[model samples]
Target: MHTLDQLKQYEKEFIEKGYFVLDLNNMEYVKEASDLLQKHLQKITNNSEITLYNYHAFFEDNDKHYEMQFQMLQFFREQQFAQNIIQSNIDVYQFLLGPDLEIQTEPYLRITRPHKPKDNIGYHRDTFYGTGPGEISSVIPFINLSEKSTLSVVPKSHIIPDRFFKLNQVVNTEVPKDSKRHKMGFLYAPKVMDPEIRNDVIPIPLKRGQALVFMLSIIHGSEENNTDYPRWSTDIRVRNSLTSLNEAMKAGYYKPLKDSATTQTFERLSQ
Candidate 1:
């Protein structure tokens, strides 16, 4: 049971910092999500004890990477997986957006192979990818991470003007492009922000069962994963439940996350 005052404290921090990190150690879904991951990896690698930290040891094959990743992402479409994706961070969502929310159906799971420079994405905003101002982003690393092993984001960058977003759109395309080219916000930091912007950027070192919550419009990116193992993480975006049901957020694209009593009553009456 969280309180309205505590929620405002989070909002104040978020509005001033563009993002915040929280420990999800007690979150029920963190263990569930990890177990689910191990379950799938066991089938793929025939290793019953596979963990996210050892992700590289199992399925980083050049040949099978696509197939393996395809199947793993498809698993995200499962109700259990999607539920964990959103419900695990429900409190964070209520703080960032509102009590009622709708989360991305096509939530993503990313495995960054070690020594891959290209894996370091660019600094950009989610609005370039069809997210709205009402949206917020979520990140959970299944393994421990630090600088060059996890995400980096420019703090308070959401308060910047929309010109950078427009420029990113010209380079990244509002319409979906190859996912590889997408993290341009992290890629072209100079084009998006001033030379001093680097001062604002900070690498978030995250442990397993920790989550980073930020505004959808925040300037964020990642660095090379030089660690011995792959960095396994998941990313999902959510919006106010009352946001317009655009194609990107409609029935097939998003799932109902939480509904306020007022919303539930209204829906019941409308039905």
Candidate 2:
């Protein structure tokens, strides 16, 4: 949990740099998240020692990337993934998003196979998908990763002029050359952004259990997995309490973060 000042400091950094790091002193959540998928991995590959990053190697159909991802997500929802988010930043949800919390996506797992540059996701903003503003994406690596195997982001892209990487200007791109859409897909190569702005993209490296929180407006995307080990990370979206989620948002689209009375009332009423 963070103090009011700590939370505000993070908010300042997030606003200025387009992202902030929330470190988990106790790494138990990473192990718990991994354990939740053990049964499924065992069934798929009879390999008990397989971990998140290397789990994809078990699949003979390399193209089944999305299918594997869906399976992991389904499993993650049943675990304590949500609890960890709040525990990781109790004040963040309160001070950042507010007490009326809504978790947009069930925390999701991302796996990048090794030596697959073509599969790397191109740069893009989450706002382009119409997720609304103040949306935060939480990313935590399941294994220690080199800089080359992590997410590359353009800090402060959100504050850039609207003329930069506008929807019509740049298109979605995928890695691995002719590969389909990337698992961590966002905006790909920006053909229109000026040279100075384009040079801002830099790789962000995080070790196991460390979380990086970024506003949805930030321009970010995954880089290729250049190491022998695959890169496994978790991603979840969240919106604040005041955001008037429309009809398309649905009832379960977001959930409360803490044990606040507001969340308790929502649970009882929804039930």
Candidate 3:
């Protein structure tokens, strides 16, 4: 367990950069959790393409799926690993927003599997998807990853509040010749408001079970999973309690819940 002071240091890093990696100090828990999750995922998926994109849990038949398309957090909750995440969330919110801050976990799970050449997600901010007015997000690696498999991000994109990336600009881009997206779907390449700011881009590589937390407005994306092995990771967002979807529903930003997976509550995410 980390002292509040240590968590504050991590929060300072996040304040300076858009993201910070937790030392996670719980390798045994991660190994056990990862093994269990991988086995669980295998029982439901053997599809080459969907597996390549880390899109497995989208199917209703894949055990008890929750959130976006992945079901690992459900396992975390069932296995008591959720306690660790909750503690981190509490410490993090306190460190970043003071003790008065509250946090809420939304119902979206992003599991990314960079397989083959073209499955990388394109450069975009979470605001594009309308996730509410909170900055905290967690990315947990299910496997140990090398630099080639790390997520590459533009460090302060979230701080660039005046500029927003539009869906249209990204849609018209030609996939890079060196990118895996040419063969797969579309690659997630990092874009900057100014190409001259090369120092803004950083590649974050993580150990199995270690998670990186960042702001949602952060301009981030990933590179091709070029290794012979598959790279799998999961992302979940935490909204400030005051900006929660439950509050948004009362504010009339979102309709009552429906079965639509892609449906979003827009008011919390953007104006």
Which candidate achieves the best TM-score against the true structure?
Answer: 1
TM-score of each: 0.79, 0.77, 0.61
TM-score of 1: 0.79
lDDT of 3 by residue, 147-258 (tens): 7777767886777863444334343254564442332223334333343333556778888757777888787766466564556565554444444443323342222211
| Candidate 1: C-alpha lDDT | 0.68
Model 3 residue pairs with clashes: 68-109, 117-180, 118-180, 118-181, 118-184, 121-188, 122-188
Per-model lDDT: 0.68, 0.66, 0.54
lDDT of 2 by residue, 67-114 (tens): 676666666666657457546665666677766666654565667787
lDDT of 1 by residue, 55-125 (tens): 66665664365456656766755645645646755776776777888777677777777876544454566
What lDDT would candidate 3 get against the real structure? 0.54
TM-score for candidate 3? 0.61
User: In candidate 3, how many clashes are counted?
Assistant: 7
Could you tell which candidate, 2 or 3, scores higher by lDDT? 2
lDDT of 3 at 63: 26
